[model samples]
Target: TSIRFCLDGDEPGRKAAAELMRKYYELGYEVEDCPPPAGYKDYNEWLVAAKLNLNRMNKRADEPVRA
Candidate 1:
């Protein structure tokens, strides 16, 4: 399974991410906040990143079955 990272366009989202990261730490999950490449700002910046990740995942022959 994959964890989707999402936050609203405001300060609250940042705060939520911080708190959620702490929880993930307790649960032993490594978290990486998405850094917008180049001139982008957030996940929806290019729209292609998400699609590419999903597509690559789908095409992988040995991908773990997401529960």
Candidate 2:
């Protein structure tokens, strides 16, 4: 089995993920670091950014194009 770490986006979060990855690696388990996107502190922040982008794209699609 593999472990995917969705930890926080701060230094401490990264440190914790590293420690856990090492531990699991030693145990022969696959480890994947799935931290939040850059500039985001957590998954919620990333989702907010994604939602904003989606809204912007939708708005653009709704607007009439000028020839």
Candidate 3:
């Protein structure tokens, strides 16, 4: 069985993730640590950025072609 943890991209988050991973490993469980992207501090920010990017792509796709 595997466990996934989504943590912030800051120091505290990193520390917590490390601690949790260590504990889980000691308990013989597979741990997967997921942190936000480089510029994002948390999952919500990353999600918002992703949504905006997707919207921009869709808008571009809807534009008419030019000669």
Whole-model Cα lDDT of every candidate shown, in order: 0.64, 0.96, 0.93
Model 2 C-alpha lDDT per residue in residues 1-67, reported as the tens digit of each score: 9999999999999999999999999999999999998899999989999999999999999999999
**Quality of model 1 by C-alpha lDDT:** 0.64
* Model 1 regions more than 4 Å off: 1-4, 35-67
Judging by TM-score, tell me the better candidate of 2 and 3. 3
Model 1, 1-67: lDDT tens digits are: 3344565434666677778877886787877554445554555755777788888878895776788
Cα misplacement distance, residue 7 of candidate 1 (Å): 1.6
- Tens digits of per-residue lDDT for model 3 on 1-67? 8888789989999999999999998899999999888999999998999999999999999999999
Clashes in candidate 2: how many? 0
- Highest TM-score model number: 3
Q: Which 10-residue window in model 1 sums to the lowest lDDT?
A: 1-10
Task: Report the candidate with higher lDDT, 2 versus 3.
Answer: 2
Q: Indicate whether candidate 1 or candidate 2 has the larger TM-score.
A: 2
